[model samples]
Target chain A: MDRPVSEAQTKADLGETVLFKGAALKLDCGAALEDIEIAFRTYGQLNAEKTNAILICHALTMDQHAASENPLSGKPGWWIDLIGAGKIIDTDRYFVICSNVIGGCAGSTGPQSLKPDGSGPYGTDFPVLTIADMVRAQGLLIDHFGIDSLFCVLGGSMGGMQALEWAATHPERVFSAVPIAASTRHSSQNIAFHEVGRQAIIADPHFQGGRYYDGDERPRKGLGVARMAAHITYLSETTLQQKFGRNLQDREAVSYGFDADFQIESYLRHQGMTFVERFDANSYLYITRAMDYFDLAADHGGNLAAAFEGTKTRFCVMSFTSDWLFPTSESVQTVRALNAAGANVSFVEIESDKGHDAFLLDEPEMHATLDGFLKSAAQARGLNATKEAKDD
Target chain B: MIDPKASAHGNLASSRIDLQLIANRVEPGTKVLDIGCGNGALLDLLVSDRQVDARGLELSQKGVNACVTRGLSVVQGNADTDLSYYPDNGFDTVILSQTLQATQKPLEVLSEMARIGERLIVSIPNFGHWRVRLDLLLKGRMPITGSLAASWYETANIHLCTLRDFTDLVDQIGLQVESCITLSNGRAREISGKPSARHNLLAQQGVFVLSRG
Candidate 1:
């Protein structure tokens, strides 16, 4: 029998945190995470058939708290703009789920979590993780919740990587997939970026070979520098010019010294400094390495289209105009691959000055596109009021 | 003959059509096709007020859906290639608003529209306009104003044409300009003695009703 629901439980029940303990996650590399702890919150009530669930994968440095308040930051979820009431994801219409990745430093178990030996943090000992490994962990979580399949898998950036992985690995499990501002494989340029970030962290004097946690100091300077460098790539030169345009910080005239005279410099510094407080340096290293190693095409004989062969899942790939890191060309390539595989795919390049972060920002065009796509997909799946039973 | 009081339906400000101008040209029950129709404002007005059997082709899926949701028959098609699919003489009057400049093959699409319809109404941004020419001569680069919202690299308009280029294309294509209207913003201006080069730019935009010579 179900226990009595308390007021807090009732509110939680409105968007409850469903835990799946001891979940077995067998990775592609043959390593397994025994007793995996998945922390996820579900918005909107699951329909009787449990068919309306949409899983929103978060980017690197992001957690499961998609629309609700983040327990770690006590701030509204990063994607609250797109996932809350009357938003594009529309919590009132669809059951939404967002989970922290297995290797995430969030509330979910990660390298920082205690090891079985009681030897403190896992650190470097955390088994080498892959995008597929994360997907496998999510699969176990979905299984425990008795969700046989998801209505859709949606995300941007690293989250978009997970969305693609979900479609490629479990094509039947996902009816539709919307991957925005992402690439199918880790490009050489992306690997170079990650390597730079990794080198920056390792070069720090305070890093002390990833064992800095025991010491009083953390790799704040190194991590901050890495974040600052990486943040520059997330935006386009056009966006930078439009946003900051060599404008002086605070004072009217340029300081001319190395004191972040430019507004863009000051903004990047702020982003870097803010990131270090919430994210662990080691976790950053592991996640960046995971991203660098990610290559979906390499595993499928260098043919990206072959990766999604015979898949029935529909896809909507979106890219932003000012997102230089993952430009519209990458999204077009993804669409071409999906099209080559005879998969149903739609593509849109939203015009925005918000760079790669446009997916997270207030983009009316993106919202409209996503809303239309999701509603149509729901209708196609026979989930909503306009349900017409037909094979998609 | 131009109707000065013609207004579009739904988000009227988003459109640049003079309902009276369209009504004066198009009779009730005439077959009409609007290319790059934004929000189907013109088509909706034409259908309801003039009883025009209107169809539209819009590049934006949202615009097409908005048109459809309003019970207006519209197709999700680009002016670039999708115009070739329609049968010849399918429409009595083909309307192109301020969307001609944004097309990839403006001349080819205009010719196609003329072929599909007995008459074609083409409205385009006049690059030869004084402000644009001054912006080019003085600024030495493409102008980014309220009209032109994109950079050179991002603009969909590969073939930017002046009023002279459009008129020359009409001559070369063996099409007759039945009537012409010049406008600065939304107000019409007389172009009888106005220099096509200097005055076209000052006028900002122009519309030409054409038919096969």
Candidate 2:
């Protein structure tokens, strides 16, 4: 029922794609998929003891280029500021592994991948995946490296869901975990937002029942609209007020038309337009659906503590003050469960005006908190400071 | 004497008069939770010296952040509100160091601590010490001593208690005092008999080890 990694194909930007030729990945929905491919990138060297490997789970719309430049956007990695030589994650001292999650289009087996019958892309037919399923696929990639346990499993938002899933399902393999700006389950409001985005994509004229990949025209308008709507949830009213504040876009005054006359409107339009170039519409639908289905406590007899009973993995849960998408109350609920389970856990609510996307931005307080946490965790795990770190 | 190796944690047991006393009563390798653990100095000491599993609940975000930086499992929570979340008898030792006076409801906190911990280590500054009594009697105002240095206007010690008052509450809550120690002018002395006026007047601070009766 399981197989090791095969060097069947290689991909650029997202790194190498390992084909599991005969392995079947069983999903939470009682479905199974075979011939799966996982794309991942590795930074720094795995220590000889192999105890210094750190797995960085990517958020939605992010690829495996965590500390490198992305080919598509020609921009630095999403976490480039925190994960590099002598940085907070400290690539010089730890081996970093970032993989594109299943149902993600960045060189990963997703809706864009071909169907088993070789008819065409799976698209909507791609087996509905869960956060746990994404983590399960990542586990194979971890096994391929012959590492017994990872030093840390870290992420934010949807990626935080994967981190929580990794710890809950494979507690023994995770030495430490940091789930930032996340919750145990998706809220009804979040699910409603996702439904709106899905409806937008499905209603696009070029969608053609999720078979638009072969057509000359893709569902750009629909996917763009979906991205535009989702992008609004990532920011706070304060951020919008301070950054744009009713400012007109390249005009003396408001045009009063449907055009993007305001700066905020133009900004959202740009976010949407750029998103469609690299992301697949069906893939977005699959990823969001997986997140909506994520409820860590549901499978554990409705007790979140039961999921982490007697777990030895250390946890550091964080939230932002302005993050309404995944509020600080959710992190408090998680901390309470960890307390009931008598687990080693820490929780911090960072002061930031940015919303759910604060984890992606450069925050000095967040940086300092993570630096100290990772340093102490590394010391506890007996990971030595690299030569460069020692000098610094 | 201060251990040079412990200086890395900034004075360690000697940093505070009562931290070492609380740390001494905790059994090695036992699960411990320190309520209102400011900056986690005592929790850090217990962790490194006794190798105990240490957790903390800090009221302020700054304190919680500091505790996490030191690798302690700490959450931002209040003593009166957040104690209900922990299960009963979850920790071997629950520590409340110099925080009972500042709590909104001291009795509820004590009862919760008793329920959540098999043994409780509590330290409180005795308000009946001769220095405090004399200062109040002579100055005809609130006392301010080396221990109770904060003025009444700015002090967080709203529910300050004398040694006898604390013991009376302990008995009322059905908690048995396993051992009690008093610190007077940087000296620690164990009080073996029942709580008395003589001990209350002499001791600047009292540290008690209690268990559910």
Candidate 3:
């Protein structure tokens, strides 16, 4: 059963939060949650024909403020470089929609939210949600807009997983998909990394078994360590060497003690310190666990191609050369499966010394690739831009 | 001519000599794969002209980007490594446009291409052209002409061969040539029914249409 979007509650930096009152969401894990709230932001205006809507899914630790300044950090959104008035995603041309995932913090219903029983934060008790559940929830948001289909769905890393899921589960709804720096399933190595990070948060003394949100104390040290570890996976050894080799941390010589001596150490310390101020520890555990459980092919009888058999949605899977976290081989595997399914697909492996984080960086080649793909997809979908050009 | 507004070189149709020759022989409404498709000029032409369902595999990232911007379905992959993944008889016509020699294993690549394609179209620069031979005799050095434009040290044509040599390789691979069009620049002329010595000295380039006998 489903409901409609209630009166929107807008935030200062993040966009409006619409409550789906008495609306039950059936999750992939056999649990149903009623009264769900989703925080989302929109850029550009939906055309009268309603054919120009594009959804930009966010990665782990990213929120719905995709191109705007975040309320917490006051810094420009993660994709500020690739999205704007005349940028690659081109707000001048397409109406872009971005939303905080259900397990995310910024204005969304997450483990940080108070329990319905007025007990406390849901914490570890927040029923585990998978990538499909998140897509199911986002589908409701698209429904609320009265939009029948999306022009394109795109993202990187975990966001890419959501894009892939959106296309596989709702092939009729997505015209095109661009999954970058992502994989069909989370490898065991990735699961290990998440396990390590989860251990960091769970082992923290102040965690009190995931109930750290309302306490006077918080799991700052543990969450910071977790961030510091996960942040390393986001970078390549080449990038770390290039950015901050063996140089000391703004000092002449090494401390030769427990303190951060190398510049790399100092950089990671800063990344971890800044991250915890914005994200919640419990949310981190939930999202990472969801990612670990994400194996789209396994759900469909171990045939990735079967999941996309005869799919009409066009695809362009992009990857970076140095991204060990989600390597080019994985992206190529996706292309091969799409080929087996006879799906319309293209792939590009960008040459970069940067690692998985390259997707979030300013890449001119990526911009042009996306611009061309979306433009062509828009043409095929009979969007206004293509219609006007045809008239001209 | 396809796509009067062409993405390559501002031409109504592709002006490349090799691509022009290859595009003509392809039937309309067939599935095609262009290995080392460069900027996808030929694939784009096939898509717009013959209504061919075109796909491409390019080794250069920039080339792949250019192809994507033109809205061509091209992947960044090496012909040597990536061909093993494609299913057998997946395409009607598989084209190796002046890229067969640069592959690490030419015969192995051909075997794979032959397996995956019902019809194989190969266009090659003949190393045994009279000009290349005359240059070797007179200058006592590697030739650098319009056909073989790059210097030997810098050229990607590592396994350069004459038309006669390729015919022998094709025979050894047990495939029969359906037709052979020998070219000087872009203008094509019919070659003899069987491989002849004249084809080696006269033709600057050759395009062969072949299938399993």
CAPRI rating of model 1? incorrect
- lDDT tens per residue, model 3, A5-41: 4556777656788878777888888877667888998
Best by DockQ: 2
Candidate with better lDDT, 1 vs 2:
2
Candidates, DockQ: 0.03, 0.66, 0.51
A100-137 per-residue lDDT for model 2 (tens digits): 99999988899999977789899788889999999999
Clashing residue pairs in candidate 2, if any?
none
Which residue pairs in candidate 3 collide?
none
How does candidate 3 score on lDDT?
Answer: 0.84
Task: Indicate the residue-level lDDT of A306 in model 1.
Answer: 85
The better candidate by TM-score, 1 or 2, is 2
Per-residue lDDT tens digits of candidate 1, residues B1-213?
011112112223543455456556777888788887767778767877888767676777566556544545554557887666566686789998767776777778888988888998877767777777888889999965545546777765556777888888888888988777777767875444223665566766677888885
TM for every model, in the order presented, reads: 0.64, 0.95, 0.89
The Cα error of candidate 3 at residue B151, in Å, is 6.1
Supply the TM-score for candidate 2: 0.95
Q: For model 1, what is the error of residue B26's alpha carbon versus the real structure, in angstroms, after optimal superposition?
A: 32
lDDT of 2 by residue, B1-213 (tens): 012111112322343657878888999999999997877899888988899989999887877887887678888888999999898889999999878888899999999999999999888889999988998889999987765666787777789999999999999999999889998878899877355789999998889999996
- Give me the candidate number with maximum lDDT: 2
> Which model, 2 or 3, shows the larger TM-score?
2
The local lDDT score (0 to 100) that residue B48 gets in candidate 2 is: 86
